[model samples]
Target: MSATRVQVVPNGPVLVSGPVRIEMPDGDVVESDRFMVAICTCRRSDDYPLCDTSHRRCRNVSAAPERLGDRIEREAR
Candidate 1:
Protein backbone atom coordinates (compact mmCIF):
# COMPACT_ATOMS: atom_id res chain seq x y z
CA MET A 1 0.00 0.00 0.00
CA SER A 2 1.22 3.49 -0.84
CA ALA A 3 1.54 6.08 1.91
CA THR A 4 -0.94 8.91 1.99
CA ARG A 5 0.33 12.45 1.53
CA VAL A 6 -1.02 15.76 2.81
CA GLN A 7 -0.03 19.11 1.42
CA VAL A 8 -0.92 22.53 2.86
CA VAL A 9 -1.67 25.20 0.30
CA PRO A 10 -1.00 28.76 1.37
CA ASN A 11 -4.28 30.58 2.08
CA GLY A 12 -6.12 27.64 0.58
CA PRO A 13 -7.32 24.11 1.17
CA VAL A 14 -5.19 21.19 2.27
CA LEU A 15 -4.56 18.54 -0.37
CA VAL A 16 -4.92 14.94 0.75
CA SER A 17 -4.12 11.77 -1.11
CA GLY A 18 -7.24 9.63 -1.04
CA PRO A 19 -9.28 7.48 -0.46
CA VAL A 20 -9.99 9.18 2.87
CA ARG A 21 -12.46 8.93 5.70
CA ILE A 22 -13.15 11.72 8.21
CA GLU A 23 -15.21 11.59 11.40
CA MET A 24 -16.82 14.83 12.47
CA PRO A 25 -17.38 16.09 16.01
CA ASP A 26 -21.07 15.25 15.79
CA GLY A 27 -20.26 11.61 14.93
CA ASP A 28 -21.01 12.21 11.27
CA VAL A 29 -18.65 10.59 8.81
CA VAL A 30 -17.30 12.05 5.60
CA GLU A 31 -15.56 9.94 3.01
CA SER A 32 -13.88 10.47 -0.33
CA ASP A 33 -12.63 7.82 -2.70
CA ARG A 34 -11.14 10.22 -5.23
CA PHE A 35 -7.44 10.21 -6.12
CA MET A 36 -7.15 13.50 -4.28
CA VAL A 37 -9.25 15.52 -1.87
CA ALA A 38 -9.34 19.14 -0.75
CA ILE A 39 -9.94 19.64 2.98
CA CYS A 40 -10.76 23.16 4.16
CA THR A 41 -8.62 24.84 6.81
CA CYS A 42 -9.92 28.39 6.48
CA ARG A 43 -13.28 27.36 7.98
CA ARG A 44 -14.98 29.34 5.22
CA SER A 45 -16.17 26.31 3.30
CA ASP A 46 -19.90 25.82 3.19
CA ASP A 47 -19.16 22.10 3.21
CA TYR A 48 -17.27 22.38 6.54
CA PRO A 49 -14.39 19.89 6.57
CA LEU A 50 -14.73 19.50 2.84
CA CYS A 51 -13.63 22.51 0.85
CA ASP A 52 -16.04 24.34 -1.46
CA THR A 53 -13.31 26.75 -2.63
CA SER A 54 -15.07 29.52 -0.74
CA HIS A 55 -11.74 30.92 0.38
CA ARG A 56 -11.41 32.27 -3.13
CA ARG A 57 -14.36 34.51 -2.51
CA CYS A 58 -12.99 36.03 0.70
CA ARG A 59 -12.55 39.85 0.58
CA ASN A 60 -9.63 40.02 3.00
CA VAL A 61 -6.27 38.73 1.83
CA SER A 62 -4.74 38.68 5.32
CA ALA A 63 -1.82 36.40 4.67
CA ALA A 64 1.68 37.87 4.30
CA PRO A 65 1.85 40.02 1.17
CA GLU A 66 5.63 39.56 1.11
CA ARG A 67 5.17 35.79 0.98
CA LEU A 68 2.87 36.22 -1.95
CA GLY A 69 5.47 38.32 -3.71
CA ASP A 70 8.13 35.76 -2.86
CA ARG A 71 6.08 32.93 -4.38
CA ILE A 72 5.48 34.90 -7.56
CA GLU A 73 9.10 36.10 -7.75
CA ARG A 74 8.04 39.67 -8.42
CA GLU A 75 11.63 40.94 -8.35
CA ALA A 76 13.29 37.99 -10.11
CA ARG A 77 11.23 38.46 -13.22
Candidate 2:
Protein backbone atom coordinates (compact mmCIF):
# COMPACT_ATOMS: atom_id res chain seq x y z
CA MET A 1 0.00 0.00 0.00
CA SER A 2 3.01 2.23 0.29
CA ALA A 3 5.10 3.74 -2.43
CA THR A 4 7.78 1.45 -3.88
CA ARG A 5 11.35 1.74 -2.75
CA VAL A 6 13.20 2.98 -5.80
CA GLN A 7 16.96 2.80 -5.45
CA VAL A 8 19.22 4.26 -8.08
CA VAL A 9 22.28 2.01 -8.13
CA PRO A 10 25.48 3.76 -9.14
CA ASN A 11 26.44 2.87 -12.75
CA GLY A 12 23.65 0.34 -12.80
CA PRO A 13 19.93 -0.20 -13.00
CA VAL A 14 17.15 1.46 -11.07
CA LEU A 15 16.69 -1.01 -8.26
CA VAL A 16 13.01 -1.30 -7.42
CA SER A 17 11.75 -3.11 -4.38
CA GLY A 18 8.29 -3.59 -2.83
CA PRO A 19 4.90 -2.98 -4.45
CA VAL A 20 4.61 -0.44 -7.24
CA ARG A 21 3.14 0.36 -10.63
CA ILE A 22 5.23 0.74 -13.76
CA GLU A 23 3.87 2.66 -16.72
CA MET A 24 5.44 2.37 -20.10
CA PRO A 25 5.76 5.07 -22.73
CA ASP A 26 3.25 3.19 -24.86
CA GLY A 27 0.54 3.76 -22.25
CA ASP A 28 0.92 0.24 -20.92
CA VAL A 29 0.92 -0.20 -17.17
CA VAL A 30 2.66 -3.14 -15.50
CA GLU A 31 1.52 -3.96 -12.02
CA SER A 32 3.21 -6.57 -9.90
CA ASP A 33 3.87 -7.64 -6.37
CA ARG A 34 7.30 -9.03 -7.24
CA PHE A 35 10.00 -7.20 -5.36
CA MET A 36 13.67 -6.79 -6.25
CA VAL A 37 13.40 -5.59 -9.79
CA ALA A 38 16.20 -3.94 -11.73
CA ILE A 39 15.33 -1.52 -14.51
CA CYS A 40 18.05 -0.84 -17.02
CA THR A 41 19.44 2.67 -17.30
CA CYS A 42 22.26 1.92 -19.71
CA ARG A 43 19.88 2.10 -22.66
CA ARG A 44 22.23 -0.31 -24.43
CA SER A 45 20.54 -3.20 -22.65
CA ASP A 46 19.05 -5.60 -25.13
CA ASP A 47 16.28 -6.26 -22.66
CA TYR A 48 14.93 -2.79 -23.27
CA PRO A 49 13.74 -1.75 -19.81
CA LEU A 50 15.03 -4.76 -17.93
CA CYS A 51 18.60 -5.07 -16.74
CA ASP A 52 20.27 -8.18 -18.15
CA THR A 53 23.64 -7.20 -16.72
CA SER A 54 24.62 -5.80 -20.05
CA HIS A 55 25.49 -2.58 -18.29
CA ARG A 56 28.89 -4.13 -17.70
CA ARG A 57 29.53 -3.93 -21.42
CA CYS A 58 27.94 -0.59 -22.20
CA ARG A 59 28.65 1.77 -19.35
CA ASN A 60 26.42 4.73 -19.97
CA VAL A 61 26.76 6.28 -16.56
CA SER A 62 30.38 5.27 -15.93
CA ALA A 63 32.40 8.39 -15.27
CA ALA A 64 35.47 8.75 -13.08
CA PRO A 65 35.00 11.45 -10.44
CA GLU A 66 38.68 12.40 -10.62
CA ARG A 67 38.45 12.72 -14.40
CA LEU A 68 35.65 15.21 -14.05
CA GLY A 69 37.68 17.13 -11.50
CA ASP A 70 40.64 17.14 -13.85
CA ARG A 71 38.50 18.52 -16.64
CA ILE A 72 37.31 21.28 -14.36
CA GLU A 73 40.86 21.99 -13.33
CA ARG A 74 42.05 22.16 -16.90
CA GLU A 75 39.21 24.43 -17.91
CA ALA A 76 39.87 26.72 -14.94
CA ARG A 77 43.58 26.78 -15.78
Candidate 3:
Protein backbone atom coordinates (compact mmCIF):
# COMPACT_ATOMS: atom_id res chain seq x y z
CA MET A 1 0.00 0.00 0.00
CA SER A 2 1.33 3.43 -0.96
CA ALA A 3 1.59 6.13 1.68
CA THR A 4 -1.01 8.89 1.33
CA ARG A 5 -0.38 12.49 2.35
CA VAL A 6 -2.88 15.24 2.94
CA GLN A 7 -2.24 18.98 2.96
CA VAL A 8 -4.53 21.82 4.02
CA VAL A 9 -4.29 25.09 2.12
CA PRO A 10 -5.22 28.24 3.95
CA ASN A 11 -8.74 29.24 2.86
CA GLY A 12 -8.60 26.59 0.17
CA PRO A 13 -8.98 22.89 -0.48
CA VAL A 14 -7.44 19.88 1.21
CA LEU A 15 -4.82 18.45 -1.11
CA VAL A 16 -4.14 14.76 -1.20
CA SER A 17 -1.00 13.24 -2.64
CA GLY A 18 -0.67 9.71 -3.98
CA PRO A 19 -3.29 7.35 -5.32
CA VAL A 20 -6.67 7.66 -3.69
CA ARG A 21 -10.16 6.21 -3.84
CA ILE A 22 -13.07 8.29 -2.66
CA GLU A 23 -16.38 6.74 -1.80
CA MET A 24 -19.36 9.01 -2.16
CA PRO A 25 -22.49 9.07 -0.02
CA ASP A 26 -24.49 7.79 -2.98
CA GLY A 27 -22.49 4.56 -3.06
CA ASP A 28 -20.25 5.80 -5.81
CA VAL A 29 -16.53 5.20 -5.73
CA VAL A 30 -14.21 7.71 -7.33
CA GLU A 31 -10.67 6.62 -8.05
CA SER A 32 -7.66 8.58 -9.21
CA ASP A 33 -4.10 7.72 -10.16
CA ARG A 34 -2.86 11.29 -10.20
CA PHE A 35 -0.02 12.41 -7.95
CA MET A 36 -2.20 15.00 -6.27
CA VAL A 37 -5.85 15.90 -5.83
CA ALA A 38 -7.67 18.81 -4.29
CA ILE A 39 -10.80 18.17 -2.24
CA CYS A 40 -13.19 21.06 -1.89
CA THR A 41 -13.95 22.43 1.54
CA CYS A 42 -16.58 24.92 0.47
CA ARG A 43 -19.86 23.43 -0.70
CA ARG A 44 -19.99 25.89 -3.61
CA SER A 45 -18.04 23.69 -5.96
CA ASP A 46 -19.91 22.60 -9.10
CA ASP A 47 -17.76 19.48 -9.06
CA TYR A 48 -18.47 18.12 -5.62
CA PRO A 49 -15.61 16.42 -3.74
CA LEU A 50 -13.17 18.10 -6.11
CA CYS A 51 -11.60 21.53 -6.11
CA ASP A 52 -12.45 23.43 -9.29
CA THR A 53 -10.97 26.64 -7.74
CA SER A 54 -14.48 27.86 -6.88
CA HIS A 55 -13.39 28.60 -3.31
CA ARG A 56 -11.46 31.68 -4.40
CA ARG A 57 -13.04 34.97 -3.44
CA CYS A 58 -14.79 36.60 -6.40
CA ARG A 59 -14.92 40.34 -6.95
CA ASN A 60 -18.39 41.88 -6.69
CA VAL A 61 -18.51 43.73 -9.99
CA SER A 62 -21.82 45.45 -9.26
CA ALA A 63 -20.81 46.91 -5.92
CA ALA A 64 -17.03 47.04 -5.47
CA PRO A 65 -16.25 50.06 -7.63
CA GLU A 66 -19.28 51.93 -6.37
CA ARG A 67 -18.32 51.24 -2.79
CA LEU A 68 -14.77 52.44 -3.41
CA GLY A 69 -16.00 55.66 -5.02
CA ASP A 70 -18.43 56.28 -2.21
CA ARG A 71 -15.69 55.85 0.36
CA ILE A 72 -13.39 58.22 -1.51
CA GLU A 73 -16.15 60.82 -1.80
CA ARG A 74 -16.92 60.52 1.89
CA GLU A 75 -13.24 60.98 2.73
CA ALA A 76 -13.04 64.06 0.48
CA ARG A 77 -16.05 65.57 2.22
Candidate 4:
Protein backbone atom coordinates (compact mmCIF):
# COMPACT_ATOMS: atom_id res chain seq x y z
CA MET A 1 0.00 0.00 0.00
CA SER A 2 1.20 3.48 -0.82
CA ALA A 3 0.26 6.95 0.33
CA THR A 4 -2.87 8.25 -1.32
CA ARG A 5 -2.59 11.59 -3.09
CA VAL A 6 -5.58 13.95 -3.31
CA GLN A 7 -5.79 16.78 -5.81
CA VAL A 8 -8.33 19.58 -5.75
CA VAL A 9 -9.61 20.71 -9.10
CA PRO A 10 -10.92 24.20 -9.74
CA ASN A 11 -14.76 23.98 -9.78
CA GLY A 12 -14.55 20.22 -10.06
CA PRO A 13 -14.18 16.93 -8.21
CA VAL A 14 -11.47 15.90 -5.80
CA LEU A 15 -9.10 13.54 -7.56
CA VAL A 16 -7.88 10.72 -5.34
CA SER A 17 -5.48 7.83 -5.79
CA GLY A 18 -7.30 4.78 -4.66
CA PRO A 19 -8.02 1.35 -3.32
CA VAL A 20 -10.19 3.57 -1.18
CA ARG A 21 -13.25 2.76 0.88
CA ILE A 22 -15.74 5.57 1.44
CA GLU A 23 -18.18 5.27 4.34
CA MET A 24 -21.51 6.92 3.67
CA PRO A 25 -23.72 8.68 6.18
CA ASP A 26 -26.29 5.90 5.87
CA GLY A 27 -23.72 3.31 7.01
CA ASP A 28 -23.00 2.05 3.53
CA VAL A 29 -19.46 1.59 2.29
CA VAL A 30 -18.23 2.15 -1.26
CA GLU A 31 -14.97 0.53 -2.28
CA SER A 32 -13.01 1.36 -5.37
CA ASP A 33 -10.54 -1.01 -6.99
CA ARG A 34 -9.30 1.52 -9.56
CA PHE A 35 -5.99 3.36 -9.29
CA MET A 36 -7.83 6.66 -9.19
CA VAL A 37 -11.28 8.02 -8.33
CA ALA A 38 -13.09 11.34 -8.44
CA ILE A 39 -15.06 12.45 -5.42
CA CYS A 40 -17.92 14.83 -6.10
CA THR A 41 -18.09 18.04 -4.05
CA CYS A 42 -21.02 19.68 -5.88
CA ARG A 43 -23.51 17.04 -4.62
CA ARG A 44 -25.06 16.92 -8.11
CA SER A 45 -23.83 13.52 -9.12
CA ASP A 46 -26.34 10.74 -9.63
CA ASP A 47 -23.49 8.54 -8.44
CA TYR A 48 -23.02 9.79 -4.92
CA PRO A 49 -19.46 10.21 -3.63
CA LEU A 50 -18.24 9.82 -7.18
CA CYS A 51 -17.81 12.22 -10.09
CA ASP A 52 -19.95 11.43 -13.13
CA THR A 53 -19.09 14.80 -14.73
CA SER A 54 -22.44 16.23 -13.67
CA HIS A 55 -20.83 19.26 -12.06
CA ARG A 56 -20.38 20.98 -15.40
CA ARG A 57 -22.84 23.76 -16.09
CA CYS A 58 -25.00 23.53 -19.21
CA ARG A 59 -27.01 26.39 -20.68
CA ASN A 60 -30.02 26.04 -22.94
CA VAL A 61 -29.77 28.85 -25.49
CA SER A 62 -33.15 28.02 -27.02
CA ALA A 63 -34.88 28.51 -23.70
CA ALA A 64 -33.20 31.88 -23.23
CA PRO A 65 -34.83 33.26 -26.40
CA GLU A 66 -38.23 32.08 -25.24
CA ARG A 67 -37.73 33.63 -21.82
CA LEU A 68 -36.72 36.94 -23.39
CA GLY A 69 -39.86 36.94 -25.53
CA ASP A 70 -42.02 36.28 -22.49
CA ARG A 71 -40.41 39.17 -20.60
CA ILE A 72 -40.99 41.57 -23.50
CA GLU A 73 -44.65 40.52 -23.81
CA ARG A 74 -45.19 41.03 -20.06
CA GLU A 75 -43.68 44.53 -20.14
CA ALA A 76 -45.87 45.54 -23.10
CA ARG A 77 -49.10 44.68 -21.18
Candidate 5:
Protein backbone atom coordinates (compact mmCIF):
# COMPACT_ATOMS: atom_id res chain seq x y z
CA MET A 1 0.00 0.00 0.00
CA SER A 2 1.26 3.46 -0.82
CA ALA A 3 1.51 5.98 1.99
CA THR A 4 -0.46 9.19 1.70
CA ARG A 5 0.69 12.73 2.36
CA VAL A 6 -1.12 16.04 2.72
CA GLN A 7 0.66 19.34 3.27
CA VAL A 8 -0.41 22.93 3.83
CA VAL A 9 1.71 25.42 1.95
CA PRO A 10 2.64 28.81 3.36
CA ASN A 11 0.48 30.52 0.75
CA GLY A 12 -0.76 27.80 -1.49
CA PRO A 13 -3.40 25.10 -1.78
CA VAL A 14 -3.22 21.87 0.10
CA LEU A 15 -0.43 19.92 -1.60
CA VAL A 16 -1.82 16.42 -1.53
CA SER A 17 -0.27 13.59 -3.48
CA GLY A 18 0.57 9.93 -3.34
CA PRO A 19 -1.89 7.09 -2.97
CA VAL A 20 -4.62 8.59 -0.89
CA ARG A 21 -8.36 8.97 -0.87
CA ILE A 22 -10.07 12.34 -0.44
CA GLU A 23 -13.18 12.07 1.63
CA MET A 24 -15.71 14.85 1.88
CA PRO A 25 -17.46 15.77 5.11
CA ASP A 26 -20.61 14.16 3.80
CA GLY A 27 -18.98 10.77 3.88
CA ASP A 28 -18.04 10.93 0.26
CA VAL A 29 -14.59 9.70 -0.66
CA VAL A 30 -13.05 10.18 -4.07
CA GLU A 31 -9.78 9.71 -5.90
CA SER A 32 -7.69 12.33 -7.65
CA ASP A 33 -7.12 12.30 -11.37
CA ARG A 34 -3.37 12.49 -10.91
CA PHE A 35 -1.03 11.64 -8.13
CA MET A 36 -0.90 15.29 -7.21
CA VAL A 37 -3.71 17.82 -7.09
CA ALA A 38 -3.35 21.54 -6.39
CA ILE A 39 -6.56 22.82 -4.91
CA CYS A 40 -7.38 26.49 -5.29
CA THR A 41 -5.88 28.59 -2.55
CA CYS A 42 -7.55 31.67 -3.85
CA ARG A 43 -11.33 31.64 -3.65
CA ARG A 44 -11.69 33.77 -6.77
CA SER A 45 -11.66 30.79 -9.05
CA ASP A 46 -14.11 30.16 -11.85
CA ASP A 47 -13.41 26.46 -12.28
CA TYR A 48 -13.66 24.93 -8.91
CA PRO A 49 -13.27 21.15 -8.35
CA LEU A 50 -10.05 22.01 -10.14
CA CYS A 51 -7.54 24.81 -10.03
CA ASP A 52 -8.08 27.58 -12.58
CA THR A 53 -4.88 29.47 -11.85
CA SER A 54 -6.80 31.95 -9.74
CA HIS A 55 -4.10 31.95 -7.14
CA ARG A 56 -2.30 34.53 -9.23
CA ARG A 57 -4.95 37.07 -8.32
CA CYS A 58 -4.40 36.54 -4.62
CA ARG A 59 -0.69 36.04 -5.27
CA ASN A 60 -0.89 32.79 -3.38
CA VAL A 61 -0.39 29.17 -4.22
CA SER A 62 -3.96 27.91 -3.96
CA ALA A 63 -7.17 28.14 -2.01
CA ALA A 64 -7.72 26.92 1.49
CA PRO A 65 -9.74 23.93 2.57
CA GLU A 66 -13.24 24.02 4.05
CA ARG A 67 -13.91 26.29 6.99
CA LEU A 68 -14.56 23.34 9.27
CA GLY A 69 -14.67 20.29 7.13
CA ASP A 70 -11.83 18.17 5.80
CA ARG A 71 -8.60 18.56 7.74
CA ILE A 72 -5.01 17.77 6.60
CA GLU A 73 -2.27 16.68 8.94
CA ARG A 74 0.95 14.68 8.74
CA GLU A 75 1.11 11.21 10.10
CA ALA A 76 3.95 10.33 12.46
CA ARG A 77 6.17 7.48 11.41
Candidate 6:
Protein backbone atom coordinates (compact mmCIF):
# COMPACT_ATOMS: atom_id res chain seq x y z
CA MET A 1 0.00 0.00 0.00
CA SER A 2 1.14 3.54 -0.69
CA ALA A 3 1.27 6.36 1.80
CA THR A 4 -1.53 8.94 1.63
CA ARG A 5 -0.67 12.53 0.81
CA VAL A 6 -1.94 15.36 2.99
CA GLN A 7 -1.60 19.02 2.13
CA VAL A 8 -2.34 21.76 4.61
CA VAL A 9 -4.08 24.87 3.36
CA PRO A 10 -3.58 28.06 5.30
CA ASN A 11 -6.74 28.87 7.28
CA GLY A 12 -8.57 26.15 5.35
CA PRO A 13 -9.10 22.44 4.99
CA VAL A 14 -6.44 19.78 4.52
CA LEU A 15 -6.35 18.08 1.15
CA VAL A 16 -5.92 14.34 1.38
CA SER A 17 -5.64 11.46 -1.04
CA GLY A 18 -8.82 9.50 -0.86
CA PRO A 19 -10.71 6.17 -0.93
CA VAL A 20 -10.49 6.72 2.80
CA ARG A 21 -12.40 5.68 5.86
CA ILE A 22 -12.79 7.84 8.93
CA GLU A 23 -13.79 6.69 12.37
CA MET A 24 -15.48 9.38 14.37
CA PRO A 25 -15.17 10.01 18.11
CA ASP A 26 -18.74 8.77 18.57
CA GLY A 27 -17.84 5.51 16.77
CA ASP A 28 -19.65 6.44 13.59
CA VAL A 29 -17.69 5.72 10.45
CA VAL A 30 -17.51 7.75 7.26
CA GLU A 31 -16.03 6.59 4.01
CA SER A 32 -15.11 8.29 0.76
CA ASP A 33 -13.95 6.80 -2.50
CA ARG A 34 -13.20 10.05 -4.27
CA PHE A 35 -9.75 10.58 -5.75
CA MET A 36 -9.14 13.38 -3.27
CA VAL A 37 -10.87 14.71 -0.20
CA ALA A 38 -10.89 17.97 1.66
CA ILE A 39 -10.78 17.37 5.37
CA CYS A 40 -11.95 20.18 7.59
CA THR A 41 -9.43 21.80 9.90
CA CYS A 42 -11.28 24.96 10.94
CA ARG A 43 -14.12 23.07 12.67
CA ARG A 44 -16.61 25.31 10.87
CA SER A 45 -18.04 22.60 8.64
CA ASP A 46 -21.53 21.31 9.30
CA ASP A 47 -20.17 18.05 7.89
CA TYR A 48 -17.65 17.98 10.77
CA PRO A 49 -14.62 16.15 9.38
CA LEU A 50 -15.26 17.07 5.78
CA CYS A 51 -14.67 20.48 4.28
CA ASP A 52 -17.68 22.43 3.07
CA THR A 53 -15.73 25.62 2.27
CA SER A 54 -17.06 27.23 5.42
CA HIS A 55 -13.69 28.79 6.24
CA ARG A 56 -14.28 31.25 3.43
CA ARG A 57 -16.87 32.93 5.64
CA CYS A 58 -14.29 33.91 8.24
CA ARG A 59 -14.82 37.54 9.28
CA ASN A 60 -11.28 38.00 10.54
CA VAL A 61 -8.82 38.29 7.72
CA SER A 62 -5.19 39.01 8.49
CA ALA A 63 -2.61 40.26 6.03
CA ALA A 64 0.16 38.56 7.99
CA PRO A 65 0.66 34.86 8.02
CA GLU A 66 0.15 33.32 11.45
CA ARG A 67 3.12 31.65 13.07
CA LEU A 68 2.82 27.99 14.08
CA GLY A 69 3.78 28.69 17.68
CA ASP A 70 1.18 31.42 18.05
CA ARG A 71 -1.51 29.21 16.57
CA ILE A 72 -0.61 26.38 18.95
CA GLU A 73 -0.71 28.71 21.94
CA ARG A 74 -4.06 30.16 20.96
CA GLU A 75 -5.62 26.78 20.30
CA ALA A 76 -4.29 25.41 23.58
CA ARG A 77 -6.70 27.69 25.39
Q: Give the TM-score comparing model 2 with the true structure, all chains together.
A: 0.59
Models sorted by lDDT, best on top: 1, 6, 4, 3, 2, 5
Considering lDDT, which of the candidate structures 2 and 6 is the better prediction for this target? 6
**TM-score for each model:** 0.72, 0.59, 0.65, 0.68, 0.52, 0.70
- CA lDDT, candidate 6, residue 51: 89
lDDT per residue, candidate 5, 1-77, as tens digits? 66666665655455667644566568877566688876655656575444566766666433345431234332332
List, residue by residue over 1-77, the lDDT tens digit for candidate 1. 98998766777777889799989999999999999999886788889898998889985745653365456565558
Clashing pairs in 3: none
Candidate 5 weakest lDDT stretch, 10 residues: 68-77
Q: Model 2 lDDT vs. the true structure?
A: 0.68
Error of 4 at 11 (Å): 0.7
What is the Å distance of residue 23 in model 4 from its true position? Answer: 0.4
Writing each residue's lDDT as its tens digit, candidate 2 over 1-77 gives: 66766656667777788755778899987665667787776676786576788878764555443454456567768
Q: What TM-score does structure 5 among the candidates reach?
A: 0.52
lDDT agreement of model 1 with the native:
0.79
Clashes of 2: 0
Top lDDT prediction, candidate number: 1
Q: Cα RMSD (Å) per model?
A: 7.0, 8.0, 13.1, 14.1, 5.4, 5.9
Best model per TM-score: 1
Better of 3 and 5 by TM-score: 3
lDDT tens digits by residue: candidate 4, 19-42: 779999999998898999998766
TM-score, cand. 1 vs. native: 0.72
**Residue 48 of model 3, lDDT score:** 76
What does the lDDT read for residue 48 in candidate 5?
Answer: 48
